[model samples]
Target chain A: MPDLFVGVDVGGTSVKCALSGPDGKVFHEGSIPTESHEGPEAVLKRIGDYVTFLTNDIGGRPAALGMGLPGLVDAHKGISRYLPNMTTHWRDVPAAAILGRQLGCEVRLLNDVRMATYGELIYGLGKPVNTMVFIAIGTGIGGGIVIDNKLRLGPLGAAGELGHQTIDPTGPLCGCGNHGCLETLASGTALAAEGIRLMLVGMAPALHDAVDGDPGKVTVEVMGAVAEQDEPVKQAIQHAAFYIAIGVANVVVAIHPELVVIGGGVAKLGDLLLGPIRHDVRARVGRLFPVDDIRIENSQLGSKAGVLGAIALAIHGLPA
Target chain B: MPDLFVGVDVGGTSVKCALSGPDGKVFHEGSIPTESHEGPEAVLKRIGDYVTFLTNDIGGRPAALGMGLPGLVDAHKGISRYLPNMTTHWRDVPAAAILGRQLGCEVRLLNDVRMATYGELIYGLGKPVNTMVFIAIGTGIGGGIVIDNKLRLGPLGAAGELGHQTIDPTGPLCGCGNHGCLETLASGTALAAEGIRLMLVGMAPALHDAVDGDPGKVTVEVMGAVAEQDEPVKQAIQHAAFYIAIGVANVVVAIHPELVVIGGGVAKLGDLLLGPIRHDVRARVGRLFPVDDIRIENSQLGSKAGVLGAIALAIHGLPA
Candidate 1:
């Protein structure tokens, strides 16, 4: 029988796990509510339980396990250095050690975006590319960079912070404490904020009506839905796209990645987000590069990216 | 006897060549006017003649010859795709073929910035680091990225066109035909233009006096000299530094290089250019990175970087 690997994506609200065969095909998948409020240890217990349940259903123990966490992870030491929404007490948690002990196998930990990029490179759209930049524009922006087909996890593992790039020097401060970060200008939260601001200004009447006059209810999805008919919403999306393009163009000029893959919530808006970005990139990139040759693509793996990427990490860590 | 190599830096006005031992020490160097107006063939002849002159000066023909050109270069095919300063007929010229036949040795061709980057990595400040970004802020800005200790020459051999990055979507058009490029705002030409503008507006009285009322005489050096006493010139330099910081900060977030080395004519102003850039970069980088950890330093090799880098290229291309 072929050995299997278990991949887990630990998120703020849920724990998504998948069982994959040696070739990286997901044979079984499951998710469980992350009862983080119960405590960090309890959350770890729940994740272990989910992993066991999946393994039992598959009728065997996996060869190894891999996990992706949404935070600062010390992958080499197998520690969760800092993770938001995973409980305050979770800081400096020896996550991989505990998980490895629970599952009776070695486990590897990695940043969520890095894992996702690895998955994409090995199994998704990045299959044949040597260099790529992956951007996840959700409530906040996150990114991973691949150069020469290897994930670029800098010495501090803080490399590929694309969202933190300052696009507007005088713009608002970002949660990361920087002013005018691309995330502050182009992420899902930025679009929602733009929507709320427009609604408050009485400019997005359609969006205002969609949320039933509640300005606070303006979300990126709501904005995306009403974007076609509402000029304000469309403009907001366009505005976000422009700043995002600046960030992307900056990367293009600096790294010259063959492909740029964008994922996460805002990417669901499809061409609405990508169109303006592509236009701005082409116009900005101009003739300096074979700008036309660079492709701005959407992630194919979607929500499963994190979990599958964890699997890729497991496969990568396997002793040859 | 130690083996020697000849390195050439082909430029618009003159061709610079140097002879160096395998250790990369320069033993002999010379220059010859390109006289490009005589046409592309004449320019190529001049380069070959210079190479022969340098080899003769060293009393021996080098083992290999390496050349760094100013534009799109097909390093693999040894073709000069498109060089800005060279004549229009120079496009698609078999640079390596013609030069190799004339010099009676193996030849290699690379973009000027790429060769310079390799030179720095092996023989200069980049010796200890694995990842770095090299920027040459001259009449125009050009850059080279070294990731995992290898230069990233994108597929088209145009990966590090840092000057062309658009900082403002609606700003002035660049020589590259893009709008608001960092080059448009921060290059030496931009500084001179800013000085001239300040002179025209009567905002820089010192600069006006320095240039004798001829705005065209306002060069980057003149601007640097007048910058301290002239508020307008000082502001112009500050403005350029701010935009340059944006470009550098953007690279910082995207590539996370261990160091950034600045070279070129503007860099000669030393702290005058680097100080503001460092301050802006630190302020912009903020918490995402240990802002203090990333160092922005000056190029130690300076003008000879081009020739030395070409020599490094010859050594790099040498077979085991």
Candidate 2:
């Protein structure tokens, strides 16, 4: 039997696991409730048990396991530095060592978004490009950078925090404690905040109707659904795209990537958001570099990018 | 006799050249007026002539020549895409091939700032770092990025335009056609502009006295000289530092380099400007990553960085 690579993507709500062959063909997939509140030990052990059961059911021996964890990851040390959203913040947890011991296989770790970027690099749009930037615009904005056909995990293993870039110095304070970060101006959270604000002000009648006037229900989907008929919804998305474009332009000028792939929940809005970002990025960076040649497009892998990236990690080992 | 490598740094006004050994030791250096009005053909021919004369003087054959050209460069194709500062804009000129043909040696080309970064990486503070960002804050802001110990010249050979990153979305229009670029906020030109504004408004009496009340004479030096006694001059420096810090912070989060070296004329202010930038960058990025570990310092090479960087490039050839 061929050795199977196991990839695990741990999210705030659930843990996704996939078993794949050396050729990257997925053989089995499953998800389990994160129950992160039970703490890192229990969650990791459960993941170990699930993977063991998966390999046993497939009658395959596990060669290596790769896991994508959210938040600040010290990939070098196989430790989770700080996972802001996870219970107990997953601070200082030697996740890779623990998982490797439990599964009796070598375990590699990376930030979830970077894992997705690796997936994109190995299997998606970024596969053909030498240099690329992958930005995931969900509740917050996160990013991963690939240069010279290898993922760049800076000295601290915490590079590519694209959303934390300050777009407006005097803009609102960000959750990251910086004032006017790109996340504060854009991101799904920013859009939802704007949607809620518009709904509260009675400016977005369509949005109000779509969410039954519940601000808590306001999401990127609700905003997109109401955007065609709602001036305020369209304006909110344009506003987010305007700031997002600045962020993208900033990264483009900084790194000059040949391709920029946008992924995550918010990116599902597609051309409505990407069009303005594309137009604005061209206008901003056109004079400095050949902006026309830089391809900015949406990610097709969606949530699966993380698991696939983990598989790539398992197959390729750590990035140099 | 050991073959000598020739490195040339072409500027808007003057061209600096250096002959260095394979060990990166500069054997001799010379300079001549750019007289860019002579156009690309004449300027390159003169450069070839100067290399020939220099080689004859040293009794050494030219093994390879590396040049750092101002403005857009296609290092891969050895073409100058658009040298905006040059008289002809140096559009689509085959610089490397022309120089190689004249000198009977291989020629490598890179953007001036990137060459300086290469120099810093191999011969200066960046020598010890695997990942680095070198920002030269002069008449304009420019930068170079080194990833995995190699200079990253994007597909367009224009990866590091650090000064062009937008810090303010609604700030004044920049020469690059973008609004509120870091250059517009913190470059030598920006400080000079602020100094001139202060002088014209009679807010900078010390600056007025230093430049003999001439607005055209206002420079980063004049501002620094009066910064101690002039509140407005101090304010202007602080303001520029504020924005420069943002640019630094933005790059830090984007690439997470182990070192960020500041070069060019404006960096001469040293701690006065660097201090504030350091403080603000720490404050802004402290929450996102380990800011304390990232070293931000002034460039030691200063004016010779470009020439030295060219020398390093000549010795090392093109980055992979």
Candidate 3:
């Protein structure tokens, strides 16, 4: 019988789980509400229960499990340092050990976005490149770096915090306590903030009409829908894309990756978001390297990147 | 007899050559004027003659030779893409092959700053860290990245052009045609330009007196000498250090290296420059990672880093 591996991606609102074979083919997948408001122990316990039930229904014990958690992860220690978006922040949680004992299998943990990068590297568009940088733009911006075809976790396993890089020395305060970070200027949160501001001022009528005059309902999707006809919304997206392009230019100069893969919910806007980013990056980095040689594209994996990358983590183990 | 390796560091003003044993122990060293105005062929011929003379004195051929050149290098193709500081730019020159045919030995090429980084990694303070960032803050700022203890030279061999990364989006024009690159804000040239401006405005009396009221005479050393007692000079250092600290902070979040070694002529300012950089980086990056765990220090190898790194390059070959 072929050995099965379980992969789980824990998010702020849901936990996604998948069972896969050695070749990275998935046999089954499921998602459950995180109910993260219940706190770390309860959330992890529910995830563990779901995993055990899935394996039992298949009538086989998995060889190992890999879980992707949000925020600062000490992958070597199997601990989650801090998950900022979660209700309790999931500080210092021994997540891998707890799940490992429950599932009675070897378990590995990685930063959620890095797990996505691993998935993209092994199973998606990044397969052909030896060096790549993955940027995930959602509620916050996150990043992963693959150099010489190996994931670089650094000594602290906290190497790829790309969003925290200061793009503007005097921009705005960030959740990470830094000012003018890439995240503060370009993340989904930033876009939504701009949308709300524009809507409140009656500039984005399409956005205002879509949300029916409720500023709280403003989101990246709502803005993307009205972006075509709304001048202010288009400018806001362009503004965010401009800063994102600077962030991309900075990374290109720092690492000179052959490919840069943009993923996550905000990236789903496709060319609307990627076009300006691509144009600006070329203009900024054109003098340094042959900008035409580097490819910047949207991720093909979509939301599944995290869970698939988790499976890859189960197969490859921690990066050496 | 033990195998001998020859390393050459080609600079704008001079070319430094050294011969070492297999174990990297220097047996002979010499220097000659680059006289770049005489053109690429003439300069390389002079370097070849010097190497031939050195080997004749030792009565042995080196196993391999490694030459570090300024500006963009296509190391794999053995070509100098552009030597920006040189008279002719050394564009598309087959440096390694030219020297190889002359000396009848294998030759490897790298960016001069990368050569210095390799030297620091193998023979200097960078020996113990698995991941490091080397920033050379001379006339122009340059950088090298070491990941998992191997030099990361991307696909184009242009991965570590750190100074070209944009630190301020609208500050000033850089030589690379970018707006507000780190080089424009924090390099040795930037410091001297700031000193020259202050002198012209009569704000830096000591600096003006030191330079005999000549702006062209203002230099980093002159600024450093007066930094202690001269308030304006101290402010200039602090301003450059602040931006440099931001550049350091950007790399910190981008790759999270275990150590950051500052080199080149401007780094000779030591604590007068390093103190504020260290302080600002800690403040900027403290929320993301344990800044204390990442050491920021000046190079211990002084000006010899490039030649020594060229020798290491000869021993190790290009990064895989």
Candidate 4:
């Protein structure tokens, strides 16, 4: 109805498409299988088909399109590099050009977590705050830095990879090939892995029974349910939260951001996960640069963060 | 003569003052015994006298004056918050007030390292670099940051305390009450202490002869010479350099900074010190980012960095 924009989120499992107004309010949203078994061109067609559905349903084309994907994005050059587990053929994909030409809409491509940070900075809790760091700890930990209401895109666009900063040099191997990365110790995967490790050692009866001896089922969701009754599962979440809180405290001490918006599947544990993080953070918060006023909270945008943040990019970046 | 500016470098033993033109040509320079024994007012007068000499020599006060000190400096308010062992009685002294009243000139006071960073940014190797970090290994390891041609002054003006960053959680006791700080293992004080430790263990024979069994005389200078010939001292220096260079490479791989400037008293060892530091850094340079492309070198301003850096504040930080 209003001047429309299209937002696309490309994930390993699926491609999500949303048609939105210039105000970042989504009008229609839908999802389609990525079908990675098919080549990138076929998967790209599925992504394009969703965009066409939005356009056809809207009675016309959108003015702008914003896309979010898992990758080390070169926003300026419209290229993706060093992405996780995507097809090797996905290297250096001129994604914006291909999508733009097919949809006949100008497109802006951005890193998914950065786009999520954009969602918070503009439409969520961060609108009231000046400096905010958005951390999404799902499949892998990723973050985005916002200063004075603008993204701190580093010289080479590699600035906000705070997840890769080694938390413990002797820590477990990270996907980034580094050791002791915060992601290796505090992400959702870390929580689930710790739960499974404890269960394998015959530590938690309820967690062991809940997973039914399958380690794959011992996920954050299973652990969250176990935490409702079992102490071991709760402890795993507590220890993970403590590590995350300490890492957040370090960030606050170093960067002095006003707020940290934590998102991801792990965060869905809500106060159970947040309580321990807040406690540990309060205790070790650097006395020198006391970020006592720092706010730790959730992403109000919910599952729509990736799309909404891309919508923000369409609204903010493409015009520039 | 062109317009003139006054630069004051407040060191532990003496306060060096210089009069330099806007063209960065030093006109007259003098040093007075800090007589920290005489206290703040006495030293303030000595500083005032230097200001008077410069203003008078240049035929009335030419323009702005900048003072550089070695401590926590709250630059925004033009105050030196604290400097251990220096008797400025400057418990949050509004430094610009005192210096401005004395010389009838606008004044800017800053941490010595930050000033040196400013100096490098304006006229030295940092001119060609977008992101620059300068570390001065002196009584304590002090540092400053300049990125995107702007100083990275955190919310508390304590942005560049690189020395305080933890390298070893259980290393030597540091002045900040933290253990294993970079300063604890690499500063001039640390270097001298390492020499004394080796001598205590009957390891550094040359150092033992150089100091003649006097621990106080075992300075970083003597240790530098010993490290070149003495195996024990070489190992100690190599170990310390190993950590220092690792810190440099971590920052390099994370930020991919264009230039890193190493300075301070120990920089006098030049290639002897940097040669090993570079080797250790090259060893840990990560495969993830463009690490090998980073340029690591000593600060070009050298011994005159203090005064020249103060001059930098005048040129860049002065209110338009």
Candidate 5:
């Protein structure tokens, strides 16, 4: 029997899993409720049970498994040091060893964003390039850096925290207790806040009509929709794009990645967002880079990027 | 005979050369005028002449010769694409090949800051650590990133241009034509400009006395001296340190290097400069790193960092 790999992306909402062939072609995929309220042990057991079920359905034991976790993961130690998005007690879990023992197969673990970036590199737009920077602009901004086709996880395993970079030392305070972090200026949460401010000021008439003037309904999606017709909404996105471009330009100068892949929820805005970011980066970077050679692309693998990257982690023979 | 490596740090004014043992121990070093005004060909020939002289001084042909150049260098192509600080005609010079042919040995090329970073990593404070970020805060603020003990030169071989990063979108014009760049706010040039402004406003009495009331004499060193007692000069240095701290904090979050090594001309300020930078980085980096494990150190090799790093380029073997 050919070796089959299973990948699981653990999230606050649900657990996403996929089964792929040795070549990374997905044969089956599924999701299960994490039920974290039941506690850490229960969630872990459910994950193992789901993996077992998937293997059983294929009528074969998987050769290996990889999981992406939203936590401070020590991949070297195979432990999830702190899972902020999960249960309070989900600390220092020896996840890889437990799952490996449960399935009698090798297990690998990765930070979800890093896993998604690896997925994009091996299976998405980044496949054509040797170096790329992947930014997931969602509720908060985070990034994964690849240089010379190798993931750069520095000594502290926190090398790619691009969102936390201080663009303005005196700007708004970020949730991370810092002032003027990119996340404070350009994240999905920031977009929604800007939309609400516009709505309160009655500048977002189209957005008000879209959400029937409900303040809470002034969401990121509502702003994205209003951005199609409203000048205020468009201006808000452009403002965010301005900060994002500055961040990208900084990353470009620091890493010189040939390609920059934008993923996560905000990337769904597509060219509406990307065009401005590209122009700003080009303007800021100047002769430092060829500028024309740096390609800004959208992530092609969508939500499956994490799972596929987990599979890539398993297939790449694990990190040692 | 044991292998000997020759390292040449080619500058517009002078070419500094060093001979080192196989283990990167410097045995001899010397310098000569570049006379760049005679043009690229003459400069190249002079460099060859210097290499020949160094070879004769060592009484043997070295195993390999390495050079560190000031501007955009394509190490893989062994070409100096543009010599910004040198003669206008020095473009796309196959310097490694030309010097290797002149010396009859293998040769490697690297950016000057990158070469210094490699030297620090292999022989200085960075030797004990696997990852480090080296910043040369002098006339301009440039940086070199090392991940997993390997220098990360991205696709364009132009990564680690930390000085050009725009910390403020509307601060000051940099030599690169960008506004609010770290270089514009924190470089020696910036410090001098601030010092002159303070002097012009009569805010710097001590500085006025130090420079004998001659504004033109108010240089970086004069400012450093006045900073010992003058509030205005101290404030100027502190302000520069604030912006520099922000840039370093941003890098700390992005790369999380185990050590941050400061080199170049301005680092002569020692603990006075390092103290504020460390405080800012620690406060900003916070939970991302231990806030303590990330040691911000001074470059031990000092002025020879570039030449020794060029020697490191020869010892670390060629980039291929």
Candidate 6:
């Protein structure tokens, strides 16, 4: 019997494939470009190549194959439901059928953030928790909620879109078409937007000079540098962080989770981002119901969390 | 053996109690002033007296007792962790142990809102729903989350305090001392404050006259009448409703629960409040996820939800 499982993280730009053992260890891994712009067929072929590469090396002993993707997913039928950046105008593109036909093995697919949280629950900090919220702050913010060792996917599986949670209904429009979402205000996208907005208003000379006068080139890195000294950049960053901290504090007060794991690109800023968030959250939450002990940390799995999380999902509860 | 249970809803102002059979049916019920001002010892005697009245028919069948109270409670330990209003300054009072020893029966105590949601889950709107968000908009906002028919008490039994979710960090200060909490923006206290502010600012004619120019008289009832014609009152009500819609919509998008059970004294306004809340939420959430189908309604259990829910908690978590 195949003791290994195939875990795939299909992103807008790349596909990360991993051969994982039941012991929650990745035995082999490789990456392949996902030209999603070229359409699902070509992308499917790339995914197949990666999966087949690992399967062949393992003497076709992989027990199962699970793929993770961004956007709405129908895990039961193994359908894409929706892939945000894909070229396909999807209204439920069946991912399992496509991936299954390609691999001829038990293939499964799940929401990327949900998979990452599951991976964390079974293997990381969540190992000792009955509940945890996994927030990945990247181009857009998203989340996964793990309660009692299971992903609480509701009737439609639209649960855990924390980034889309309205922080300010009158603020800014999110990629999800909502206004004032925490993700649109505090994620990497928000940081970049703030940087560009500041530059447009004649702020951040170093960033302006670094990007050679092109505000679009003013990425989060430049903003972090500018925030190091520039008052305007620091204020803008603080505004978003303050709101994000309030959001976290509220989630803690409401969901009362054992841990909160934050990952994705923005977490790379380390103390610069987390410091304001921690301070604001503590101040806002009050000393009455102290959250002084709530364990908050960056994703330990780093880039491979999604892949390992998908494998964990299969081990937990993916239909054969 | 008496398979029935007695449930008590202990509030700051009054105590509502009910006798319920194992089949989820209430046999008899009554309400009395809490007079928590009299002290914890006095209140405990009152509770003992009420329990005696409930089972007096057949020399009192020494059955299980369930109690739900406002404030932070240690449900498993049957203790009041912290309650600002309950004169019991008795933090961590093991009421269950005392009552059990006094009455010769096991006792269970829970946070009032959590018990109310549990009631809804087993005997009210939360029926048929494994995942639900129960929000009660009373003098203060209180919320409870039921995941897979199980109440989520977090690690410390504080999981379902959804009223504290921050919709705005700069909005207003909540009774809990948090700024811009959902309760600060959407609860009855918010509505009352808005009404008082509007009347104090000479904004409402009908409401002003309805209360005879006394700011104290501009109650929610007077404000409701003003809403029929007064734009400021309507605007104020709608403003509260708008944020409420956002709060509920965010919960819908986050948990994707099949139903959102809304109850409380303020909900008594019915469509006057809920209509705009529903419309605003739909407008904000958009058709992307479809929340129009989410069931939002007033509590059918009236004030009896707490006790019934308490009973459900004890009976369901019984030997099985």
Give the Cα lDDT of each candidate. 0.82, 0.90, 0.89, 0.73, 0.82, 0.76
* lDDT, residue A48, candidate 4: 81
Off by over 4 Å in 3: A1-3, B1-3
Tens digits of per-residue lDDT, candidate 6, A223-251, equal 77767767788777777678678667767
The candidate scoring highest on DockQ is: 2
Interface RMSD of predicted model 5: 1.5
Better model by lDDT: candidate 3 vs candidate 5: 3
Question: For model 2, what is the error of residue B232's alpha carbon versus the real structure, in angstroms, after optimal superposition?
Answer: 1.5
Model 3 vs truth, CA RMSD? 1.5
- For all predictions in the order shown, the interface RMSD in Å is 1.4, 0.9, 1.0, 3.4, 1.5, 1.9
Off by over 4 Å in 2: none
Residue range B218-243, candidate 6, lDDT tens digits: 66767877788779998887887887
What docking grade does candidate 5 earn? medium
Give me the overall lDDT of model 5: 0.82
Which of candidates 3 and 6 is the stronger one according to DockQ?
3
lDDT tens digits, residue span B177-241, model 1: 68888888888888888888888988999999898999778898988888888987888888888
lDDT for model 3: 0.89
Q: After best superposition, candidate 3 residue A194: deviation in angstroms?
A: 0.5
Task: Give the clashing residue pairs of candidate 1, or none.
Answer: none
**Candidate number that wins on DockQ, 1 or 2:** 2
Give lDDT tens digits, candidate 5, residues B79-167.
89877777554688888888788777888998888888888888788887877888888777888888766887875567888888899
Candidate 4 per-residue lDDT over residues A154-175, each given as its tens digit: 5545556656655565679876
Q: Please report, as a residue range, the 10-residue window in candidate 5 chain B with the lowest summed lDDT.
A: B282-291
* Candidate 3 docking DockQ: 0.76
lDDT of 2 by residue, B196-281 (tens): 99889989888888989988888898789889989999999999999999999999998898899999999999999999989999
Per lDDT, what order, best first? 2, 3, 5, 1, 6, 4
